[model samples]
Target: MFTNYHEAIEWIHSRLAFGVKPGLERMKWLMNRLGNPEQSIKAVHVAGTNGKGSTIAFTRSVLQEAGYSVGTFTSPFILTFNERISVNGAPIEDEEWLSLVNEIKPFVDELDQTELGAATEFEIITACAFAYFAHVHQVDFVLLETGLGGRLDSTNIAVPILTAITSIGHDHMAILGDTLEQIAAEKAGIIKEGIPMITAVHQPEALAVIQNTAKEKNAECISLHDTCSFDEQQPTETGERFTLRTSKRQYPQLETGLIGTHQRQNASLAVLLIEWLEQEGYISVTEEQIYEGIRQAVWAGRFEKVKDHPPVYLDGAHNEEGIDRLIETVQAHFFSKKVHICFSALKDKPYKKMIQKLEAVSSSIHFVSFDFPRAESAEKLYVCSHLDAKSYDDDPRTVLEFIQKKSDDPSAVILVTGSLYFISDIRNRMIG
Candidate 1:
């Protein structure tokens, strides 16, 4: 019923007054009002501090290869709002999204007018994705990624067939919790009773908390180490090849399009989850489908190479653990060059630790503001980074221009990293 996409998006944004209240009550109430569309479809709920998005991508690709109509919902879009919701890896069409928004506007408006106030941006988007997948597209399976923490996240409405916690770490401490144990407990909250809880390998403390939670809920706990292992292999520009060994099956010659050595573990976790799903009779999957999916899956902004000469790499490594991985990846791949870094992070992250890591890796650093309210200023970033960088730019465009001018040096590698919002801005500028 809406005339155009912009009008619909604007109307939805206008209704976002509640601004990210961390609880399931609002989502539950709104879903009840909208006929509880989330309950209509089977779901695989994924949560963690990091790697959840890439794991979701791998899972979706595998499911689609197995011939299921798959719906994937991820957060913090790199380019467009529609990128958050996808069916079979393609972003939702703008016109269709507009119509869908219009259809849901009256109910959403009523929720806003009530004592509940209004849904946050994430809540509205989660509702829209559920409605679209369960009601409109009628997908066979939905791969749901939690936006922030898992327990109180808006997307936790559905009782998923399988719940996955990809590697937990210290991110979103202000909202979730400060300690790894506390944050792991929040991520573990997504483990529903009687559902198989699949968790990536974690620190001992985090692992214990997740396992105890699974026990308390009478859910089956499957660890990455117990379920799967991998043979060490070197990565090539094309992809990395590794042999994945599951409890009952061994997959030889598995390849992933995503970079970074950490992704091998993520890919293994996805394969193991698929194995669990098959055992539970949730979906029948073939080895061929798994191989095909592994080969084709692509996730942006995680060590993604945007340019070849002068080698520009883009990553959304906002947290300490993620930054450690990013540092490792850079050292492994571009060891010869003293990395030229551009960085930014949100106010809530461990900015000091991240800056220290970058300082260790880079010869010179350029700080750029991402234009988000949560984004720290370039001057603040420079001070925190502990680097007497050659320059700093509040404007992202100016930073990019500086990089272009310096790009003539083939030995120089420009690494654009930090917050996902910063990654979104850089990606838009490059592709636009």
Candidate 2:
């Protein structure tokens, strides 16, 4: 048994070497051994390529505003590992994490000897989250964000009361498939029989897949494209403001702390889900609660302004679609300022295409690779850029210092983008 948090965390992370095996058999066995803790909790299964975390943040904040304690399970945490399983935005205490790891470590060891083999790192973490929410401390609702493609993801073990697909895009293509249709099929796999779904997917191929899946499951799928109508939508200095009209209600001047136009779509998904919950008699939440919740919702590392003077922002736009959104956000907010970019990405991503997009908006681009197995090297990312005003560095700190020196101009704005892992590292150094 692990006696300390450090040992417990180390053991949990050690399972990473086993790599990802996409199947539910191991998760089913683990859950069964743990008394099926997932079955005891009311969950909302969320799947998508990019906006899942933002959607969950908006939803959780709204639920909390209505006086409900919400548990959220998300991946690739922007802050700490403990943020993966948090209650009302607070990471579970160290003592709670230790207890959870102790309770599940035996099953993890036992599973290693079985036909299904040892569970992956994500599976163990998913189990810990389920056990904590169900057996240790219950909450009004648990939001489960799939770590990868939905169908085979470990978080799929939970039978959620509601499900949402934030958006379908090209991400995790190696495991999920290359085409939008194939990716959509994997994402739509979260749709359960008779469980209503909500989505913000606009792509025809992707939307069709989700619609067909919902129809096959005999579930009503609510598409934001069909249900939501925006009026007077405009970007704000801090975030955004818009009048959102859904089939059921009209929210005047809805505001959010999250940046970009895509965030508006994300916030809309949360509003729709919360409205659906209230309409279905599962929860009671006033409209005011939702508005306040949205206004208060903030997800770190998504165009987050860490410093005011000589403004410096961080955005985790690792993929092409994410980079597009990041570009739009930068254009919308800092069009007048000279934008200097610090970028890094995973080796497997289409950094060439993403860097191409960022090049259009950047005054100068600096590339630096961080310490991750899959991370692309600074030289490789730098070579991908066609910009004459670009530089490369092996150490991110050196690149950061160089960018800080350039940020002396009052008209210059510094942006750190690309991989979330890289952003997490930079955020700790800059803020913590």
Candidate 3:
């Protein structure tokens, strides 16, 4: 058993050596040994290429306002590793993490000796979240965000009461597939038999894939476009304000602290999910609670402004779809201002295309490599840009200094984006 927090965390991270083994066989085996904790909670399985975390954040906040405890299991933590297994937006205590890791370590060792081989880092983390939610700190609802494609992702072990796919786009092409339809099929794997599914996907081909999977599973799928709609959307000084029209009701002046119109879509998904929960008799909430929750909800790295006086905004626009949304948000909110972008991304991502989209909107872009193993070189990222206002620095501190100096101009809107890992690092440097 581990005696301290750091040792336990190190051991957990060490399993990264196993990398991303996609099947759930090892997860099933581990969960079975752990008394099948995943079955003990009412889980909401969320899968998508982007916006999964934001959607889960919106849903969790609404449920919390409705007076239900919500547990969230998400990947690539923004600030702390403990945030991956959080309840009510607060991360689990280190003591709880230590206890959970201690309890699960033996099963991990035993699973390693089996033909199933060692559990990957993600599998172990997923198992820990299940056990913690079921035994250590049980909650009314648990939202499981898929780490990768849905079909074989470790989080798929849960049989969720509700399923949601936020969007389908090109990401992890090597594993999930290179085409939108193929990727959509993999994401649709979360739709279980007879379970009601919700999605914000509008792409005809992608929507068809999810709809077909839901039909095959005898699940009733609701697309945001088909049932719910939002309009009069406008960016607010603090966030976004939009009017949502549902099949049964119209919610005008629905506001969220999270920025962007894309966020309005994510917030609407949360609203619809809560409505379904209420209609199905699983939970009850007032209209005021729903309104207040939407207004109060905020996610960390999606167009989050960490500093003032030049306004350093951090967005995790690592993929092609994500970059497109970020561009839209920038154009929508900061159309009249000068937009300066500081960016970095994983080498495996489609950074070339992302850079092209960013270059279109950015007045100047600084490419800096961070401390991740798969992070792209600043020089290579610089080479991809055709814009005259581009610079690269291998050392991020040097770039940070330059950004701080450039922010002296009140009209300059500083944006630090590209990868979530890079955003997390920059956020810590700027705020913490």
Candidate 4:
């Protein structure tokens, strides 16, 4: 049994060596032994290449406003391990977390004796979240975010009432597959028989895959294009205000604190999910409640401005599509200002493509490496770049400090992005 919170977290993170094992057999066995805590609560499974976290955040907030306790599970924590599993916007308490770990450790030890492979880090975390939410907190709804691909992610062990695919893009290609259709199939794996699924995927190939899967499973899949027509009225510095028109409801105005036009799509997906939850009598929710939830939602480290006076912003745009949105959002808001980017990426990421996209908005690029096994070094990243504005830094904070010290103009914008892991390091430093 772990004596302290930090020790518990360190022990859990130490299991990263097991890596991501495809398939849910280990997860299923673990859950079965633990009395199936997932079955104790109504769940909504969310999967996609991007926007999954933001969508989870939006859904959680709205459910709280609708007078129901909501439990959220999302990956790549911005601050602490507790943030990965939260209820009503509060991270799991260290005491409670240690207790859960102590309870589950016996099951994990038992599994190690069997022929079944050891549970991965994410699997244990998933179990912890399920046990905490269902048995301890007793949340009304659990919104689950797939850690990796939907098909075999640890979180996929849940039989959700509803499922959502925010968007299908090229991410985890080695595991999920290289093409859009293949990735979509992996994402669509969360859909179950007779369940109602919602999606904001617009890619023709990806949409076809999801539609076909939904058809086969008898899941009533709703697309944003078919069910609710939406148009972005405008983008704001704080967030975005959009217009959404659904079959039963007309929200002339919808607002969210999350940045980027892509966020409107994620928020809209959350609205649709809430609407379905209400219509199906699963959870009673009003449009006003949904609007309020969207308005108050705050997701950290994605184009999040944590400082001013030579403005510093952080975005966790690890994949190509995510980096594209990061560039777009930066250009949309900071085009008038002189922009400098402090970028880092995991070795597996398509940093070349992400860098290519940044050429349009950035005046200079400072490549910085974070502390991660797979993190791409600044020296290597600098060598590959053809951009005239490229440089490298071993210590990421030095780049931020340099930007602040050198920039006399208040309009100068400094963006630190590329990897969520990098943003995690940056955020902890800023908060301290």
Top model by lDDT, which number? 2
lDDT tens string, model 1, 1-432?
569999889877775565779888878987887789988989999999889988988888898899988888998888788989999989999987887888777777788777877778788888898889877898888899998888899988887999999998888788888888999999999999998899994699999999999999999999997667788676767556889988879888799888887788788888988888889787899999999998788888888888777678889998999998888878777788868988888887888888888788898888888678789988788877666765777899976785786678878988899998899899888865
Give the per-residue lDDT digits (tens) of candidate 4, residues 1-432. 889878877878877888888888888998898889888889999999999999998988898988888888988899887888888888989999889888888888888788987877888999999888878998888888999888888888898999999998888899999899999999999999999899999998899999999999999989987787877567787888889888778887788888887888888888889888888888887778888999988899977888877778888988989987887777677668888888889999888888878777878888889888999989988876777977788787776576766469776788888889899998888775
TM-score of decoy 3 = 0.99
TM-score, prediction 4: 0.97
Q: C-alpha displacement of 125 in model 4, angstroms?
A: 0.6
Pairs with backbone N, CA or C atoms under 3 Å apart (clashes), candidate 1 = none
State candidate 1's TM-score: 0.96
Candidate 4: minimum summed lDDT over ten consecutive residues — where?
398-407
Q: How do the residues 242-354 of candidate 3 rate in per-residue lDDT, one tens digit apiece?
A: 99999967999999979876898889988988898999998998989889998888889999988887787899988998999999899989999999999998999989999
**What is residue 273's positional error in candidate 2, in angstroms?**
0.5
Q: What is candidate 2's TM-score against the reference? A: 0.99
Give the lDDT of residue 335 in candidate 3.
Answer: 97
Off by over 4 Å in 2: none
lDDT of each: 0.85, 0.92, 0.91, 0.86
